[model samples]
Target chain A: MVAIAIARQTVREALRRRVFWIFLIVAVFLIGLGPVLGFLTPKESQTIMRSLGLAVILLAGLFITIVTCIYLIPVEIERRTIYTVLSKPVQRFEFVLGKFLGGFAIVFLSIAAMGAVFLALVYFQGTTRGPDAGVLVWLTSGKFPKEMVLGVVLTFFQMMLLAALTIFFSTFATPVLNFFMSFGIFIVGNLSSVTESLTTSKNGLTSAIGKIIHYMLPNFGNFNVQNAIIHPTTEISNQGVFIRNNIIYALIYSAVLLILAVIIFDRREV
Target chain B: MATVIKKYPFETVRRRMSLLPAVLAGLGLAAFMQGQIDPDAKQFHPKDNFGKTANGGLNNEFLLLPLLGFREAAAGLLWVRCDEFFHSGDYDAILPLVRLITWLDPHAENVYITGAWHLAYNFTDANERSDRRYIAPSQSLLEEGVENNFDIPDIKFELGWQRYDKIKDFKGAEEAFKLAVATKVNKNSDDFPYGAPLKTLHILAHTYEKQGRIPEALEEWKLAIARSEEMLARSPKDYSAKSLHEAEVRNYAENIQRFNNRYSTTGHDSVNPSPYPEVLEPPPGSADKTPRSWDVAFKPELRIVRPKVFKVGGQFNSQDGARIDVRITDWNYQDRKITGTLNDFSVDPAQTILIDSISVRKNHFEREMDMSKDPKMYSFSQDFYRVVLSYNPRTTAPHLLDRFGWSGEGMTDAEKSHVFMDTDPDRTGTAYIEGQGAVPPVWDGKTVPFTNHSQPLRLIKVTYKISREQIMNQKPISENDIVSVQ
Candidate 1:
């Protein structure tokens, strides 16, 4: 019950930050402008719109999750708020869990907002056109491309995993250091998919690097279904099973990271 | 690092180590998920979307997008750049870009079609002989496109057209068109959804007719009509579809009627009674062989009338679809016998022209080619040249094949006498005029006919040792071996 109250307090704090709203407004605006960008492409307007819209949501979600979560624990500690929180009946592990859940709330709410906008843009791609074509008609003329929901769902879970990683780092590391570490790890983690191809490379050195990246880092690339989304005819064996497995993987990995953060923060001096 | 670790207690380290099992299990699931998401072998190419398909030529910059997971969008952008290359006439640049674009977007059907078309038609030899070397590669692209787009018939139609138009392999064309007709038609398909397979059926019928299979052609036409009816049923208000269906039925009925009457022995036709072979098959086997084997008597002759043009006049059996190979080259030129793998793009600019297009079927063949229009292509710097009028049955079209089948078993050349320039002014033949001291142009006493032999199928050879004066019309042309009627 105490953990839930603290978690709600963290959510309330994140919502008031101007930076959170800035990130979302910009992301929504870019996704809304996807139709105009579609015309600039030589052909394959539908493909380009879906790719750009999904890409916008993902990039925006990444910044929102990282920035929101990284500042959560550090600012509380700097302002002596952690002392007040620790004075409560809340256990240190519970406090860390509550902070992580609050960060989770921020990630969920922001990604859900971006995802809804992205889905809306894709659904109304070309339902109406010509002189009478208005914004509402453009959204209605085309058939709703529902396959994009798969990409959006996967992206959300992937960002949640990223949020957990940032909160874990903020438990011990400074916010500036936490930001760089999270971003760098994300970059290397995205390369987790490349290890398979790199292992078959003729160069011995490339093979070694590929193995290291594959085994050591978190697998962020597993969540990317953009290629299959753009060309749905490409087989994936079982979409339901594949997506369920990915969500499970993200949860398990995020749990492991949070537990390690809780253990490390347990003995630290306030 | 050792001091800091020593300062830290083993108790904290033990606590962190306690979570090792959970960490290990998490990483294990992560690896499993990676494998599940990206299986080892898929029908579609994963490496291409990432621009990591080929070995050396692949651009590293192209790899950047896929690394960030925007692979499909990156492919689309590269294809746009490739379009710009097409408009600028940067043909050579387009080849490499096509490789990159298709590797990136294997599902881009239009890219595959345009790339193959450019390969088959763009690069030409100086004399306008389409570089036949690229034909195989072009067909290969279309084949790959079909494999990638299993449900789409657009690429299959292109493959059929390539076989029919360029390669002239009607059997291959028929197979491709059949596959195109059999594609699972989806009206809502993004690329080439099936409104109808009428176009494919139409082309299939034409291919059958070209191969002398009239019965099969008639069936294909009927199938096309049926397909149109299916489309009309789906959209009753589609007047254009209904009219098109009507036109096809009328065209098939009228054309089959007139065609049967013209090809029939009795000058009459009945689509109901029977179709082709029974009514249209010209007598085959021995009956077809007897007349075509030894009847197309070839009387060959050639003369240089203009700087670039030559007058090739020859008589054949008049059985139609007969073409003679006429070659004008240096007197010492020998045919290059390419033995091993042919280096395809090596069809370089020829110093002299060898256009194997002398029409010899209808009574007599006579056409003046205007080589003067393109001097850069047909440069005649050689002093003495030979005009070879040869007809090999192996290379002739189907109409000629109806007559001469067995390595030119029926085609024959008239008797060619060993004619040469009498360089010795002392001799006095009727070919020599008293005022024109030396009748033979300007050559040594021993100038022989070009690579012609007494062996059969060598066709006719006209060896003339003419100088610049003869070419300039300053003197009468020394026409030798002009075998006239006995």
Candidate 2:
């Protein structure tokens, strides 16, 4: 129950941050420009609107995770608020978990808002005399698209995973260093497939090191189902199994990272 | 100074160590999930080496940036850059960028098609001196597009047009157009408007026609007509170009006329009239009525009386009369000599008969053939026989309907043979005679009419009815029985 209260306070604190609101407003503005960009390629209006909208949401979600979550513990320590928190009956594991949940909540809400903007742009682009208007109307109506909703959910899971990594880094490193380290990990995780392929193609030490890196890094590439949503031709056949598996994977990885953060914070002098 | 000794809490250490198992479990689960999901990665996260070879190898940045989980963003950036290069008329720079864009997002079929078009048409036409250099690359790009997006007909249509109009390869154009027509896409869709498929068929027919593939061209034209009509029925507003449709209909009709003119006998007289003047025959043994000159218009009348079917080996003996009547309207008829041959449609020339100097009296001549004479030469064969006639004006090639009249331009010997042996399979029995025969010859108790014209040659078709038993037992007769009355 203490963990739940801390988690709520963390959410409130994140919402209060000037950086969060600034990024949110900027993301919303970018999404609002989607319909204008769509006019440039009137034939592909729906595709352009959806692609740009999703892109804004993804970049905004990443910024929230990396910037907000990385500074959580460092700011708390710098201001000596950790003493007050630790002085309470709060456990170190609960604090780390709360911070992760809080960051995730902020990112999720931002993405949901951006997703709504994206849907509206898509709807407007469809009804207009755009090139793909006919195709869009045939594919979707006034109602929400389930596939797009699924995409949003997967994107939330991805951002949550990134938030956990940031929290883990904040436990041991300075805010600036933690920011880069977390962002680097996200890059490496997305490109883990490169090393995964290397393991099968190369020989000796290179292959062995590639295999280790492939297993150690998070597979963020798995969560990118935006292409399927944008181009129906590439939609996955077994979407149920895919979404379930990815959710499980994100939860497990985040849990593992959070556990490590808790262990490190428990032993820290601060 | 007495250093304060830090008291380590054993319970806290033990509790931290207790969470180690959970960390290990989480890591294990992550590894398992990675293994399950990696193999089924989506298009945005395509295999690093998916299009490396075909795209001439993407740069390390492209191959690696997507691993950072922003492949779509990178592809979008490349697409914008490519558009810039395209608008600036920098085709040389556009190639690599378009290749990278397509590699990053192979599902961007529009990029492939537009890129190939730039290379094949726009770039090549941009510089006359370097046109040849771009042709092969353009074709290669289109081929790659086809490989990646086989379901799209637009790419195939572009390729077909490239081969047809730019490359002048009709066979290749036909193949690509065939695929374009066969590829089924939504007609109502923007990519394929109504009558798009019909247009493809029309192009295919035109290509076949250009190659002189008449039969195939006719078939495609017919199909296009039918499809165009269907399209018009479905969406009249969309297919309101009635002049174009009527033009296609007229083209089909013209082709049908040409085909009939070459093969059918019923419509030959109207379309292919003789280019010679008519001549009236004089009384037998009386003064000839026509002048004697190299350009003398000698109208010949020919008649054939015979058994409709004849035994090949046995004598082609008709109890009534198996003979050809020839009448000429000439003053110097006694000075003229008629010689020709009855050639079989066999590859061997030894099976043909050489007719030498058929005798003429006044203005009339008659030739009779009895298979009893030289049965080996007139041996049994269920095939049509063609007569080749030559007379005093042999220097001016014989006026056979096939050799002199079918085409005003002179024909080679091989072309003439093709006309007799292959052109009209049903009209092979219609033989041409250079001399005039009886105006009307009696046959089977009826006067058989002759198609007499002043073309210097007359056509006479005769049918011979023969029993198989008669042909099997017939003996070879003396060569003297082949008579040429003078």
Candidate 3:
């Protein structure tokens, strides 16, 4: 019952925010631009739509996670509302969990609504163009020699994990700090494979730096399945299995980050 | 201030609030979506004027504005498809489509080369069924591109290659290639990482070859071969560029050899050992008259027709209307003439040899065969009462088709022995002629209907049926086979 209460309160707060509506309008515009995008490309309309859809989900999710964590908790403290809530029998962990769930829910809703629209557009494009981009993707799947789909799924999760990492950081750091730190992490994580290669390189100092980066930086490259997905004809079955494992790994890693954020928030002086 | 506070802003408030954001947002969005909406917009407008970045990105980077990027990539693919059409001699669609692509993305260098080759070569498929009109537009587009982008060497190379391959204008090709070599190639490492020096070397080598400078071309091909070998040695597993270079060097060497062979008398008469035993040489001072055997033959069924096989330009059949005339000579004795009358002497299997007569001297014989009739079939006789020799009634199905004509279905013994005597099963083992007696000695009823055997014994006039496989396998035949009759 208490968890339900927290979830509802977080939901109410998300509804009241103007940025949520801004994200919703952006989502609608991008989704509505689907048919126009279809008309423009005429070749890879669905592929473009799917890619843009994923990006919208990511951008909106990031915005919600960042803005909520950065402003929500800080604003509560600035308004001295934390005292009112904390003076009650409520625990700090519950407040943090509730806030995180609220943000997660809002992002999930946007992802669901936007993903459905994107799929619908893909279906429409497929029917109109007579296997435009999406149907070719479908027919090429099982009929030919394709690489594993799991590798691609893993990469997608890895990107989502990066988003979660940003949210976790925003819980503790200033929005500007979180933004730079997350962006830097994202860039470094994309290049983690290149760094990992450097770890075994000839240059001693460079290898040392590479090793440090390999350990210190989050490897977001694991979630990238764009190449495999785009080239579905050459996918290996083993890669698909590998992606499933990586998805679990990314989720666990994100969970660890959330736990760390909760711990940090629990001990805050505010 | 009191005057300004008068109620004069009712209409202004309504108008300003609505129009300001709408116009700003609308303009901004329009600017963003301009490429998406328009097909012939400033798409792929060259940004890199060989040095400075054009618009936002270098080398037309801003031109890749997602909408245009997709189109550009598609055009690149269309270039490849157009090339296939051009190669298949589908010039009807090829010329216009290629022009459209170049108009869309003028920077496409490969399309120019491929399309130019199609037009210039005017090389038709075995079917020879497509229109010849594509050549004019193809050449025009290439010339236009050359005029438009006179600085790009790749375009000039395309022109030069087309001239050399299609028009046989080697001198003109050489001049164009030289011009291409003179172009200042991109020196920036990032612009062309492998650098243009190697590319220049290649162009120069091609120019030399086109100019008939064999020694220079051979040297260039060898150098390229050495460079490729070195690269391959360093990275044995890497197939990317090493294989391409190797293929180029090999093709260059082959072309040089072919050029040399065409002009040299030695190449004209060159013949390796025959697969069959036709030449007979006695051992030194031995009593045996048989030739030294390369392979041991026990009772080998030797079959030899008078006139030493068929000749395209030979004259006269045997006087007996069966046997052909021949002259025989022995190194140890005086040359002798053996003349015999060829009777019609129709047998179950009549050997068609159109002989005049045969004369036999002491250990010598000669016979003459006539070919005066136009694509006619005649029988030959060794003896007056009985035909001693008959054309092998059961010619292998593959043998007949390969020599006389390709029916492209099945072969019969009647067809092989009577109609297609030149058919050698061994030369073209995979193919067999079908529809016996229906197709003429030369005509099987299809496009470009004429074919000669590896030995050139028979001429097939094709009018019907497909050639099967592909005509691309012709070069390998001409290079390795095509026996010289020196």
Candidate 4:
């Protein structure tokens, strides 16, 4: 019941935010314009849909996650809202959980609305052309529409995990430092494959630097579900092996970073 | 419940957030597990389903309209944009542009169908000895269109016509024609002409003829003739009218003539008599003009003629198939003017007698033969050399009638002689007058009995007859043995 209350209040606050509406408008407009663009392209409608869908999800999700965790959280603290909140009957753990949930709700609502339009475009495109003979093969190829929706839901959770990491960083550091550190970590994490390749190179010094960057950054590439859309025909195994492996890696990395944030925040002279 | 709460440590806050990842991971795990035993694969062959759905979706009306409009614009742009490349005959430029246009508008089925068909049929494939490679792709494109638009007969007709006309796959063409005809009839449409049914009928007739079904072929030809005529009548007097009518009449007439000519067996009632001189009297001023020899017959026109050393290809029986230049400078040779058929046919392995002239005995003969077989070169019988051999057979002896297979089985020997005497040379070796004299024009050296005109020798009837065994067993010889029969 307590978890439910925290979830509901967080969801409500996110709905009231102005940034949420702005993101919603942009995403919706793009999704609606998909058919128009498809008409112009004539040949590459399906490919265009894929590129745009990925772009929308990544851009909107990142905007909501970074701004809420980095700017909003620090602003509330600077305004002494954290003191008032802490003075209340709510536990510090609940506040952190609540803040994470609120930021996630805003991102989720925006993604869901945008995703709905994007999915409708895909569905409309499919149906208007009549039932595809490939539908059966496509269903067998990847997670079906139901399973894909489940994947998307899981992806939102993945973004929430990243949000938690951002908040942890913002707790102790200045806004400037927080922004730099969060963005730097995000960039490096996304390019983990590049870092891994660098580490395996012949140069010892470069390999050392790559390794240090790898350890310091959270490997956010693990959270990417976009690859699934690109090659839906891929035979992803059922051992829960890859998904479990990525989650474990993300959790471990996020935990270590948050621990460091906690240590720094605890020692700060506020 | 309203009492003051303790501040939770950061570690505790981090632990609560951790459960979110764990739960999401569980969901993802369940989904992945479900995918392993995919029910879709057990029930269906995936590729077939994909093709069927792809075709079905492509053909849907709504899907086709926007695609057609888009493709038209796109193809137009591409045609202009790649103008230079196409002008240089670089097919690489045009092929991809057309491919892209088709991909965008698959249901604009005419693009691929018409494009490939025009490429093959109008240009390359229809050229004199049709190209198969060009035809195959053209047919394949039309076949794809047929499969996609199963109800449309245009693609079917195009495929069938190309199969018949270009590939010469008449049976396959007949099948496609049947399909198109059946489609048109069942659909009950008048606009699209059902050429297949008519084509099928024509092919059936052609097949019957090939199988030696003469009666059936005749009947079928008559039927086709009637049908084509009927179509010509009903059709508007368009540009094809005059030629169509002319072709119909000409074909019918020719077919009837051929039918009559094949069955005709009328025998020749009278043999053609020789046009050579009945008697040859000696010249008055000669040394041989003594009292006893005064009665000796001689041809007076033989004096001014020159003997030619002509080059002749080897006989049909020799392996070397050699050619020889023979010098014929013999002025007093008694047979200088061979009046009767001088069967100086070659028997020598290396030599062939080239007959240069025969104007009462001296006229030119131009001939060629592939000496792959031993050539026939036989000397005339004694009776042919007789002074009175051209007269009655009982009284003096007819020179031509005294030959083998003559009189009793006259037709057989006459036919053999006719076969040998024809001037149509074999393709392998050639014979020509190649000495220091003007090559004379061909002559049989005979005139009609009481007329001033010379007896005509039909040159077109001349041919070389070498049996397969003779051609195979022929031996080669040297060039020095070629002889000229003056």
Checking candidate 1 for backbone clashes, the offending pairs are A124-A139, A126-A142, A127-A140, A127-A141, A127-A142, A128-A141, B293-B410
- lDDT at B470, model 3: 12
Question: In model 3, how large is the Cα lDDT of residue B150?
Answer: 55
lDDT of 2 at A259: 84
Error of 2 at B394 (Å): 36
Candidate 2 on B1-486: residue-level lDDT in tens?
Answer: 433323338798688889999898889888888787766664445534352344245567766655544555566667767777778878778777776766666566667677767765553211121223345566666666666555567777888888777665666788888887776564323335532456787888777654434456667878877766766787787645465577779888775554444333334445544222211212226565451111212222222333322212221111112122212111111211111110111122123222223333343444443333333333334333333232321112212222322211112222121121122222111222223221222111123222221222222212222232333434222322222322
Better of 2 and 3 by lDDT: 2
As for lDDT, the candidate ahead, 2 or 4, is: 2
Q: Which ten residues in a row have the lowest lDDT in candidate 4 chain B?
A: B386-395
What is the lDDT for B440 in model 1? 34
Q: In lDDT terms, how accurate is model 1?
A: 0.64
Cα-based TM-score, every candidate: 0.67, 0.62, 0.38, 0.37
Report clashes for each candidate as comma-separated counts.
7, 23, 55, 30
DockQ: which candidate is best?
1
Q: Distance from true position, residue B460, model 1, in Å? A: 15
lDDT, residue B453, candidate 1: 16
Off by over 4 Å in 1: A1-33, A37-43, A67-70, A74-81, A127-142, A172-217, A232-237, A267-270, B1-20, B26-53, B85-93, B122-133, B182-196, B240-244, B247-267, B270-486
Per-residue lDDT of model 4, residues A3-108, tens digit only: 3455566667666778867876786776566565444333345434543554465566766777666754576568866666666665544555555556666667
The full ranking of all candidates by TM-score, starting with the best, is: 1, 2, 3, 4
